[model samples]
Target: MPKVDAETIVHSIAAETNTPEETVARIYADALDTYRADARVLDYVPLFAARKVRATLRQNSAKPH
Candidate 1:
C-alpha cells in the first residue's frame, strides 16, 4: 500500500463525513496518535487510523446532541 500523509487522511475523512476541516484535523491527529502508540505493523498505520476516526465520526453523528 502507498504511504499516506496526515494531511491527506484528514482532508479525506473530512470530505467523506462532511465534517469541518479543523475538526477532522484534530480527530486525525488524535487517531494517529492513538493507533501509533501500539502499532505492530507500520505499513497499515494510516489505514487503521483512518478507520478509527471514521467510526468516531459516525458515532458522533448518530448522537442526539
Candidate 2:
C-alpha cells in the first residue's frame, strides 16, 4: 500500500472523528509505534471510524428519526 506518515494520518483521523488535531497527531505516532508498522492505510487509519460513526448516528437518532 501507499506510505502514510503520522501527520497525514493525524489530520484524516481528526477530521473523521472530530478529535483534537494535536491529540490525533500524537495518537498517530503512538499507533505506529504501538504496531511497529511502516505504513498505514485509509481502510484502517486510526481504527476508530466505526465507533465514531456509530456514536454520531446515535446522537442524531436521539433527536429524531
For model 1, give the 10-residue run with minimal summed lDDT: 1-10
- Candidate 1's error at 26, in angstroms? 1.0
lDDT of 2 by residue, 13-57 (tens): 667766778865654555545544554544464444334433543
Which sections of candidate 2 miss by over 4 Å? 37-65
Whole-structure CA lDDT of model 2: 0.55
TM-score, candidate 2, is: 0.48
Alpha-carbon local distance difference test for all models: 0.87, 0.55
TM-scores, one per candidate: 0.87, 0.48
Highest-lDDT candidate:
1
Name the runs in model 1 displaced over 4 angstroms: none
Clashes of 1: 0
CA-only RMSD, every prediction: 1.2, 7.0
Q: What is the lDDT of residue 38 in candidate 2?
A: 50
